[model samples]
Structure formats: structure tokens, C-alpha cells
Target: MPKVKRKTKAKSKGGIFSRFRDYISQYMTAAAAGVTVVAIGLAALFWAGGYFGLLGEQVSRMTNAGAVAMGMDVRRVTAKGLDNTQRNDILDAVGPVIGSSIFHFDPHAARARVENLGWVRVAAVSRLWPNSVHVSIRERRPAAVWQMSGTLHLIDENGVVIAEEISDAEYTNLPLIVGAGAPATANEILRALRKEPALWGAATALVRVGDRRWNMRLQKGGDVKFPETDISNAVRDLARLHDAYGILDRELEYVDLRDPENLIYREAGADETIAG
Candidate 1:
């Protein structure tokens, strides 16, 4: 017998593989567009950065702005740690930084330039921001004008030679030191002389005899021999002898106070000033 044929349903041609391929195509296109946009953004950023001076040679401009902002003008610098003359000298040293951007100026170079000056023992410099620089200084205090190898040494309390600008008349009050280690010798000499300001004030020059001995010449004329040991005692005795003999008058040629007990003296003709 003929039976009614049931309609069979057919499956769709597009499966999971086709759906995956379509999704992959859309994703690839979107990724490509995204990558292109990112590349363009980076290129524009770099170009703008270069044009607006965000890179290379911007330091020079920064330096100039810094100088102007910090009040590094020639006139303003006078009120700082340096005098007008010293300021001019500093400007000359930092000439390159005068109109430079603060970022461009080499701080180390500037410091080195200023430190090379005569009186600058310790120097410091820093930026005040906006438009100013602050400078601080520690100057060397002269202990005495030292004389070494016949050359004058204007030294400090630490025995460092600060300057060679010797003026015989200007520094007449400072003592002269001779022989080896004159700088160190000057220290010892000043120490011994403090006990007797009358003698210390009268001293015109102090000569170091050998590396181990000390001799002081009076302002008027005469030598004071200080013993290697008990130098303080020798100085006290010398002061007493000066009081006794009136050594300041320049009558006696030399006095040997190295022998504290037996003070010795010699006239201009006798020659010998100290024993041993």
C-alpha cells in the first residue's frame, strides 16, 4: 500500500567552522585598524614633542630662562657673597651660563669656575627657582704672611697658601717664617708668641732654623732663640730678658733664650745667637 511520505528536515550548510571563519575575519580587520590608529598617534606625539622643544637643544633655552628668572644679572650678583670686582670675575668665569637656560648650564663647570678664584676656600651654589640663584661662601682667614724659599706665602690658619699677592707695606704687621715647613712652623711660632704679646707684637719675622728649631727676629733688631723642648718656657724667659735688657732698643744683637736658666746674648760683633 502507498503510504504518505514524511518531509525530512535538511541541516543548514553554515556550521561552527564557517561561523568561526567569519568571526576571525571581523577581528583581524578591527585589529589592523586599531594598530594603524596607534601608530599614527605615536608619530604625531613624537613630531609635536620635537617641534615644541621637548627634546634636544631645549637645555639651552632652559638655561637662559633660568638665568633671567633667578636674577643672575650682573648687578644683582654684587649683593651676593662676592664684591663687585669678584662678581665681575665670577661672571667672566660663568660667561657661558649668563644667558643660558638653567637646565642647560653645567652646575659643576660653574662651581669649578668660581672656586678657582683667589679667596674662595669653600664655595657652594644652588638654584632658588623661578629666577634666582643662592650662593654661600667660606673665605680663608689669613694667619700670617709666610715666607718660604725666599718667596712669600700668604697662608691661612690651616697653613694653606691662599694667595701670593704680597705687599710688604700692607702686611707689615704679619710675621715672616723661614726654613723648612714654614707654614707649620708659623703655627708653632704663633702659639709660642701668644704667651708674650709684647714680644709677638714686636716680632717682624720668624725664621725656622733646621726643621727642628725656631728663631724670631725683633722689629727693631735681635734674634730670640726658642728651645726645641719647653718652647713655652723659653718664650717666657725671653720675654723676661727683653724686659731686663730692653731688647727692643736694638742694642744687643741677639739673645739666646733656648737656655732658659742661663740666658745668653751677643752684640752685633759677637755673631753667635743660639747655643746648639
Candidate 2:
């Protein structure tokens, strides 16, 4: 007699996680996605409430209205350097105190307008209570008059060109630095001279040469050459010679310090010669 065939149960291949793991993982992932959505919604709600209005235009209107209610009479507006016409321009950019709230005023724009004065390197602005506006300024200290591209312009220590129209009378004492990136180059030359009081007083112009060489021109038009290698030694050696012989007191063309073995110079009224 034929008996009824019985079905056998299949064995799991990937441990206990083979069957229900997929559904469980899918549910957990869906839950994590839901949490992220909620977090984003809350952040957006806060940003909108702060910058915009929590309840439509009501909050915005209140904030702006509070500032408007404190408008000033503008009895006095004071700014420095009115002679350069920058004061008026800056004041115009800042607007008047009357019927205006300092909260809405743009100090950054006012600063920019003041900087257009050419001499003003930086500017500070403040609101002086209800009736007046106060402003302070910092002018750029000219480091040198740079000769670039066949034209000369006044420059600050940071290589920023200050003005093209600075009269010599206003900055006659400024150094004359020539060649590319002379402002940065001058810093090193000036630093070296600062170590010796004699050179500090007599060093005038710094002339760049050969892209890697520097020449220090004294107040009397005597040039001191520094080779790219061991340049400091050259300067020290020259300074020592100058201290010993008082070479600067005589007529000379230049002092070639680049050669350590021998020092050469051109007599002020005579030909070039080697000095021990």
C-alpha cells in the first residue's frame, strides 16, 4: 500500500538571521530615516523663527519697529579729515542720524568710503548717543616711494600702494625702493641696518638686482653689494670696515662686499680701487 508522502522542513543557511533579518533591518532603517526628518524639521523651524518671523510678520515688524522708534535728531555729526573731502563722503554713506536708526546703519560701508581718502589706511566708527555720530581714523605710514613700471607711487610697508599723488614735501624722508616686490625686499635690508646704528642712519635706498641680489645705497649715493650667498656676512664685513676706516666720510662710488676675499670701492672723485 502507498503511504502519504511527508514534507521535510528546510534547514536555515545563514544562521538565525536568514529569514526575518531583512524585515527587521528594513524597519530599523526606516525608523532612523524618520528621526533624521524630524531633526531637520526642528532645525528649519528654529532658523525661520529667528531670522524671519515665528508668527508671520508680527515678530519682524516688532524688531524693526523698536529700532525705528529710537531715531535721532542728528544735531551734530563729526568726522575727522574733512579737509580731504572724505569726511563728507563717509557721512553721506553712513546717512544722517535724523529719522534713522543706528541699528540699520552700515558701519562697513562707511569705513569703505573713508578708506577712499587715500591716506586713510583704516577707520573706526561709533554712534555717539542720540544726537551725534563719532568716527576715528588711522592713516597709513608710507614706507617708501616705489618705482614700478616706469612710474613712482607711495607705498606702505606691506607693499600696498597708498597713493600716486603724495607730494615729496609730505613724505620726503620715505625710502626709495626700486625693483619688483621691493616693499618686502626692503624689510630685510632695513632689518639688517637696524642692528648697526651707523648704517641705520646712512642707508637710504635699496636696489634689487639679479633677482637674488640686494644693493644698499647709502645717503651719499654709495652702493653696497650683497651676494645671494652669505649676504649677512658681506654686510657685517662692510660695516666693520666702515667702522674702522670711516670709509663713508670719503668720496666713493660703491662698496662691493659680495667678495669676501677682497673689498673694492670707487673713490668719490677718483677711479675704483681695492681696499683691504
User: Which candidate has the top score in TM-score?
Assistant: 1
lDDT of each: 0.68, 0.71
Off by over 4 Å in 2: 1-70, 73-75, 80-99, 112-117, 194-197, 200-204, 218-222, 229-233, 260-262, 266-275
Weakest ten-residue segment in model 1 by summed lDDT: 76-85
Q: Candidate 1's residue-wise lDDT over 1-276, tens digit each?
A: 999999998877778789999999999999999999999998898887785466545765666556667765332232255532266666665554444444445656667877777666766766554334455656777778877655776777777877785766656666677667778756765877877888887777888787787888876677777777787777777777668966656655777766656877776766565432
Where does the lowest 10-residue lDDT sum fall in candidate 2?
A: 81-90
RMSD of each: 8.3, 10.4
Candidate 2, clashing residue pairs? 251-268, 252-268
Clashes of each: 11, 2
What's the distance in Å from true for residue 135, model 1?
Answer: 2.4
TM-score of predicted structure 2: 0.59
Q: Give the Å shift of residue 94 in candidate 1.
A: 4.2
